[model samples]
Target: MKINVKLFATFRIGRGKIVYLDYYEGMTVKNIIDELGIKKEEIAIIIVGPHDGTPEKMLTFKVEPNMTVHLFPPVAGG
Candidate 1:
């Protein structure tokens, strides 16, 4: 299975804005984040398809083929 991943904010430092990952049957969003070397604490928002991904969901949400996952890091400064 292939999953599309989009990185936003500071999450795109070394990695590009969009990436396609080869995922397994039981792969979760957390697995993708770990493969990209991103810390869970650094992610502020996650959008899996049309749903707002919560922290618990990120850990347990199963990634389906062709699903698009967006990851955003926390932003500061007012």
Candidate 2:
């Protein structure tokens, strides 16, 4: 299955903003984080779903084909 991945904030320090990955049928958010070399603790938010659909937010959620995943690292603002 092919999914669109968007890395945000600190997650984009080294990697570009977007990447297309060929994931397996039952791949989870953990796999995407590992593949991007980002620690699970580094992720602050995970949005997964179709482009115009309401995203399902959860790290343990199973990623389906053609889903759009947006990964956000911890943010700090004051």
Candidate 3:
């Protein structure tokens, strides 16, 4: 399965803004993050296809083929 992953904020340091990953069956959002070497605690929000929600729920989400995954880091303000 081909999955499109979009990284936001600090998450795009070494990794590019958009990444294409070839994943296997039953791959969860957390699996993708781990593959990219990103820590779960560093992710604040996750959007999988049409479903968007907290990291807690999204991390465990099983991704489908050709689905786009958006990951955002915590935002800091003055």
Candidate 4:
């Protein structure tokens, strides 16, 4: 299966803004993060299956093919 990943904020510093990758069935958000060499703490939030509904939890959410997964880094401001 293939999925489209979008990176934002700090997560996009080194990596590009978007990428297309291959994944197997039952692949969780953690699996993608691990594959990208991103530490769990590095990502503040993840949204799967478009921008509707709730964001998927990193550890337990299985990513489906053809879905758009957006990764965001921690937001800090005064």
Candidate 5:
């Protein structure tokens, strides 16, 4: 299965480009994060299939084959 990953804000700055990741059918957001080597500090927001997603739960959010995962950095502003 392949998932579309979009990196935003500082996450993009560090990663250089968005990515398409391939994994087994049962893979979750945490699995992708581990495979991509994304640091915990670099991630602020994670949205999967129109709702808030959790990274620590591992399989909490079940991703469909070819689903788009959005990654955003922590907002910093006055």
Candidate 6:
């Protein structure tokens, strides 16, 4: 299955607005993070809803075939 991943702020370094990743059945958010070499501490926010909801762990979190996952890095504004 494939899911849509969105990266924000510093996390968007070499990546564009969104990316599609392939995973096998019964894959969890944790699996995808590991596969992409991303550490939990690096993410500031993790969401399953579109532009809403609380941040959570992707590793233990489960996602469906077409779910949209949003990730952001810690940000500070003056």
TM-score against truth, every candidate? 0.91, 0.80, 0.93, 0.82, 0.77, 0.78
Model 4's number of clashes is: 0
Candidate 3 least-lDDT 10 residues: 49-58
- Model 5 lDDT tens row, 45-65: 788877774455433576888
Looking at model 1, which ten-residue stretch has the lowest summed lDDT? Answer: 51-60
Predicted structure 4: lDDT:
0.75
Tens-place lDDT digits, model 3, residues 1-75: 699999998899999999999978999999999999998898888999789987788888999999999999888
* lDDT per residue as tens, model 1, 1-71: 78999999788898999989997899999899999998888888889977876566676788899999999
Compared with the true structure, what per-residue lDDT tens digits does model 6 show for residues 34-76? 7666677787778876434334635567788988888777787
Question: Which order, best to worst by TM-score?
Answer: 3, 1, 4, 2, 6, 5
Better of 1 and 3 by lDDT: 3
What is the lDDT for 34 in model 5? 73
Q: Each candidate's lDDT (Cα)?
A: 0.87, 0.75, 0.91, 0.75, 0.73, 0.73
Task: Return whichever of 1 and 4 wins on TM-score.
Answer: 1
Question: Candidate 4 residues 1-78, lDDT tens each?
Answer: 688889997777777898778979888777877777788777677888653222345556878888878888777888
Name the best candidate (by lDDT).
3
Error of 2 at 53 (Å): 15
Residue 10 displacement (Å), model 5: 1.6
Pairs with backbone N, CA or C atoms under 3 Å apart (clashes), candidate 5: none
Clashing residue pairs in candidate 6, if any? 29-58, 30-58, 30-59
Cα error, residue 74 of model 2, in Å, equals: 1.8
